[model samples]
Target: MTFPIRTPDDLHIEKRDLKFGRDDAPPRWWHSNDPGRTAFFNALSSTFPVGEKFFMTAVRHYRDGTAEPLRSQIDDFLYQESMHSREHVVFNRQAQDAGFDIASAEDRARRTIAWAKRRSPIQQLAGTCALEHFTATLAHDALANPEHLGGASNEARRMWQWHAIEEIEHKAVAFDTYLHATRTMTPFRRWLKRSVVMILTSLRFHYVIFRNTADLLRQDGRNDWATWKGLLAWLYGRKGLMRAMGLSIFTYIKPGFHPWEIDDRSLLKDALRLLEAGKPKEMAA
Candidate 1:
């Protein structure tokens, strides 16, 4: 459930055409009816639409010279990321209706991505590789542990489920692109660069996600000690998300690490089921 270490030479990358029906907005604490958990997911969504563009840019930088199947996969990756960004924009607007600071969150996300673009191309790809892992780990967990989305509104849950599925589908593209683009660097140097960036990326994400979560929760009047205590428990308690995600993050340090090495593609069954359930009748095959 934790590690996502698997790849196939003939991996089929398909864009899922699914729609979440949101005729009416859900409560502000849409996640399981808990402000803290809701804040966590909202904070993540706030960043996803804007931040994923940087991911596409990093992959595109090195994808031009890739061989046949990977070239096609990279194209699919670009398309999926564009779709993901757009979907999250819709999701964020819903959060805005709930009084969350969408403008401030967008500002922070853009500033973060802008800073990342200023780094060397290799570094930018390294950061993207790291982020892909972060998201893929989360996606794997959501599929493996249904409780993660237990309290979510149907529409919101469907969007995240769909997003998670696509994240897992193309989990290795950025890393593969990184290797293709960094032929000039020695293996050891490349490892060092990626390892260092993953560490920093982890820290920066932790800080920003929670900072945004706290801010959003405050706006929702979830400022009590009981709320913070319950939220912290949900994050760090046994089988909490951060704990589940840690192994995947640390695995990047292993020699000859490939994302597919920790294969959890079996989890895709659940994701596929969700996709099937969410497809518009017109788009249903």
Candidate 2:
């Protein structure tokens, strides 16, 4: 239960170059046709292009002189994250074209990443690992529960499902890089550092998303009490994403945790096949 645990031996992360069609006329709730859900995901999409750059840079900071499987994984991790940023940029533009206030939300996200960039490189990588854990948890929830994505337009569903699959595929890259780079530190020090980073990152992460949600609501001219009420219900209700991810989010703090410890690759079988099946139709644009 100490440092330097093995990264998954099974990951084969190949970057997929794909695109989702933007509708000529899109609904406000592009995802699941639900305002709250759509706002939440819109917030995520607006953030990804900037956030993924931070993830890649933070991990790449440690790439020099890295050897063996992790070296190749790091290269592919960079490739995958770069692609995620590109795809999400296109998706976010579609959100903006749909009349959402994506530019304002992305301004907030940019400021957040700017703050992280001012921190030390180690801190940057630690924060990246923390956020990766959060994404992986949400990815698992989306893949495992059909309701999260249920009723969404096919293009929207397919883009997110593709993103989720890749998130799970490379969930541990930053953490593995962190562990290798920090192997000399005491276990307690390592744990304490990451634990603090995760706590701070999680708080900031939620604040940004919720703030962006409110921004979207106001832009839609639905900032009334009932709209806020609906957002709360969507977040905390029986079928809510927050309720489902409650326990999974805390798994990162376990002493000897590894991304593949849970073996959810079983979930990837269909996701990968579907992604492979759709690659040909990914438009260039």
What's the lDDT for all of these models? 0.82, 0.81
Give the root-mean-square deviation of each candidate in angstroms: 3.7, 2.9
Residues 120-220 of candidate 1: C-alpha lDDT, one tens digit per residue? 98899999999999999888888778888878987788788888888888998888777777767788998898899999999888888887887888887
Specify the highest-lDDT model's number.
1
- Clash counts for the predictions, in order: 8, 0
Per-model TM-score, in order, reads: 0.92, 0.91
Give the residue spans of candidate 1 off by over 4 A.
Answer: 1-6, 278-285
Model 2 bad stretches (over 4 Å): 1-5, 22-25, 274-285
